[model samples]
Target: MKVIHLHQEEKKIIEEAVVQNRQAQHKLYVKYAPKMLSVCRQYIKDLQQAEDVMITAFMKVFVNLKYFEHKGSFEGWIRKIMIHECISYLRVKKEMKFVEDEEFTHEMHNNIESQFSVEAIQFLIDALPDGYKMVFNLYVIEGYKHHEIAEMLGISPGTSKSQLSRAREVLQTQINSLNKFNHGTI
Candidate 1:
């Protein structure tokens, strides 16, 4: 994979945007909007809603640009903002519910074949309940720990663990059913 290096002009654009330069800000937006929209879509099922969230996140990013310490990648900082906006949108729209940890005792099994495409895995995840989907995306896809997920979503770590466990079980069941259906055994 070829990495596209940001030229010095790109760095200057960010610096100028930090001071609220409109043209520089537009340049930054044009450069990052497509990638950021894709990130928002991972959390939001609706494309229009994802676009709204991405716009909101970009607004926050521009407003907070002055606070960026330049210690990390600018794209990373922007992506973090997009993720937070998605979580906030989910909280407001879906109102996450936590199942009791004790209720999740089933041992998880992976019935999904390795040959399945990424889209198939994503479709199974998208079928999960809101809470399960959020936890699964944060932990399995985004590499967040249970403690971090709990802090982000204002739930207990045990709740995060339970949701993730339930997500895996549900996904396995769905995959098994799909396999049976494909093989005409259903």
Candidate 2:
């Protein structure tokens, strides 16, 4: 039940820990773990796996803490590590295999807007089939280009685009359905 106050003393303790004080290091981990765990949970579907990933990611963060200049937020640095860990975990899991199908090339639509509730959008994302979810997460949420997604997932750029398009269509359909339901109920 520790309150995370980013006061001068807290920052000084973290800086001291980065300079090799074991107690401050432990305190830093205790202070940051809850926040970092929440970030890990968003990227990973399973709770236990999220905890494992966070643990490993924090270890890496602690090891590299000395390299952290005050250039960015400390939380942002930890977030990047957690994200990389999640990517590695997903890559190893191979939950969805990426296939290159030339017939499924996607043409991007312009200026699409969504006014759905956050819960509705999350529901749609969670409902997506595994392959579509992975590609959508990487390309849309993570801001990865199709070529990079193709390289990372062993799929063709066309397939990456197609998957993203399909994911969007599915999401839009979900939103429409939810909107209809809302209108009907009201």
Candidate 3:
């Protein structure tokens, strides 16, 4: 499955699939499942729930493929669907709570100085509380605005900003502790 080769012709295949080509549709699913699963996992936090969300999102994408105008990147469009589906799953779970800290600010400048390895940072992100993780992923990783995150997660923009601030603060603290512990060992 050379996606790069199909990138140019995917619109035609998708259009055909929209009309009636089960094989083309299946090919599209196979092509997108892994990436979509990753997207789903960021929001749901449970492997099974993520898989279920990916399946539901793919179904919606295929069913609604006719609405696609090829005006933008197909991958981006599908990614949006996965994001929406994950948010919908989260909403149904009613886990959209936000941390409130009036004094919290995005002042974790030390963590961004390239001192922490990618694996270390990723581990810290994975360990974040659910609310923080969701906000961080939406705002930082996915390039969404705090207002968009607020609407997606049903929280206020202040809450989204607060969660991101708290997440960064936690990551900074963890990194500092890790550095201190490592230094003491040396």
Candidate 4:
């Protein structure tokens, strides 16, 4: 079944939400909550905690709806908010200690997407130290520049690059190990 385009309706809902219309707010929440939760889960490994962050972010979104100009996708705007909320949650929940390495070689993990399930990849990411995971997700998943990540996470761009390099190395090692074990070579 083809779903009708939501942009026109979303604009109307967004306007109503700006005025604090409860039903419009509820509709927006129902439409966005699932995707927002997934965005939260990318940063937060715990589903329940991700949900909490998503809810908090949604509240902020509704509160700040008036500031949302029609220049971009509402989903993207919400996602940015969700990412910030996750960062805040992580900050309060755990300290992210970034390692400063300016010269680590970048290692790419190739051809694993076909072999690894999304959950498996997420598990590997979840295993990373908080700082590495945050940089890796921002750089790799969310396509943020290192400088942007550094600014957002309050670290140097060099530190962000280093964290990404280290994260790639660790994930590559783990995936290689998994490949060997699965192929009975280890």
TM-scores, each model vs. reference: 0.86, 0.71, 0.84, 0.92
Off by over 4 Å in 1: 1-7, 106-112
> Which segments of candidate 4 are over 4 A away from where they belong?
1-5, 107-113
Best by lDDT: 4
lDDT of 3 by residue, 1-186 (tens): 688677668877898889869998998999889999888877776789899999999999989999999888888999999999887787788765676655557545563455677656766887888789889889888999989988877778888888998888887778778877878953
Q: Give the TM-score of candidate 4.
A: 0.92
Rate residue 169 of model 3 by lDDT. 84
Q: Rank the candidates by lDDT, best first.
A: 4, 1, 3, 2
Q: What tens-digit string does per-residue lDDT give for candidate 4 at 1-186?
A: 223456777898999999999999999999999999989998998899899889999999999999999888889999999999999999887757888777766655566554888898899999999999999999999999988998999889888988998898899889889989988999
Query: So what's the TM-score on candidate 3?
Result: 0.84
Q: What is the lDDT of residue 15 in candidate 3?
A: 84
Cα lDDT of model 2 by residue, 38-112, tens digit:
767656767799899999998898889888876767777887787778778877887665555666635556554
Relative to the true structure, candidate 2 has a C-alpha RMSD (angstroms) of: 4.9
Candidate 3 ranges with C-alpha deviation above 4 Å: 1-7, 100-103, 111-123, 182-186
Model 2 scores a TM of 0.71
**In model 2, which regions exceed 4 Å deviation?**
1-14, 19-23, 26-35, 103-117
Give the Cα error of residue 112 in candidate 1, in Å.
4.3
Q: Give the whole-model CA lDDT for all candidates, comma-separated.
A: 0.84, 0.77, 0.83, 0.89
Q: How accurate is candidate 3 locally (lDDT)?
A: 0.83
User: What TM-score does prediction 1 earn?
Assistant: 0.86
lDDT of 1 by residue, 91-184 (tens): 8887567775745655465544456787787778778888898888888877899899999998888888889998888887887788888789
